[model samples]
Target: MPTDISRLVHNVNEQGFTALEKTGLRGQQDQGLVSTLISRDLSGSDDLCVSWGRILPGQHHLCHHHPDASEFYVVISGAPLVHLGDTDYRAKPGDGIYIPRGTTHGITNDGDEDVNLVVGVSKPADWQFVADE
Candidate 1:
């Protein structure tokens, strides 16, 4: 029996998985920062990736960008400062921000409480492109 290349297996917990924080990036922090959840190269979806992150007060995620994919962030708790290119915006609960592909963006927790958000990418990311500047 030959498996069709176009057919994908849809299993929630059966895909190739990796934790973002465990990768040793600058954004990986112990107390004030965390990439708590992630789903990458999802079982049946090659074009989409998702991650959930929490940033505590005074913590910041290094500025970076995704050249090959667009991203959307949905704020789930608290409020955070979102930087898109050269502009900054405040995103609170239920707020969403759209970052076009190849645009620079980052987030920081300037409030007193922890900020949690869900980020979705249209395609798998190329970490090499995430710059510090």
Candidate 2:
């Protein structure tokens, strides 16, 4: 059964970090900021997962890589710095980024507003291989 993403489970919780609980993290400090898992393999599609994340100013996602799946991120609001492989890009509303499988990437919200991004993965994530580097 295909789950309607619009009707999927959703929740927002305080992340314990003052900056994260308040607005979000800024710069490289965002590694532990707000993370919301919006959807998973509810449809039994072993090859897909969708998630929405918000990063507060000065916060960042640490360098990491996926071994079997390519990832895509669509900027829904605000601007953020994105690091993929050896390149750095600025992402804002309406922008999209595609990360190839096995590539190192991360995101940083250094602006004033909260950075919202919608992420989709080509394969159901393998938790054991997900490392925070």
The Cα error of candidate 1 at residue 67, in Å, is 0.9
Model 2 RMSD, rounded to 1 decimal: 6.2
RMSD of each: 5.7, 6.2
Best by lDDT: 1
**Stretches of model 1 off by over 4 angstroms after superposition:** 1-42, 125-128
Predicted structure 2: lDDT:
0.67
lDDT scores of the candidates, listed in order:
0.68, 0.67
Task: Give the range where candidate 2 is weakest over 10 consecutive residues by summed lDDT.
Answer: 15-24
The deviation in Å at residue 6 for candidate 1 is 21
Our model 1 lands, by Cα RMSD against the true structure, at 5.7
Instruction: Write candidate 1's Cα lDDT for 39-127 as tens digits.
Output: 34433555676666677788777677877778899999989999899999999899988999788888888899988777788865443
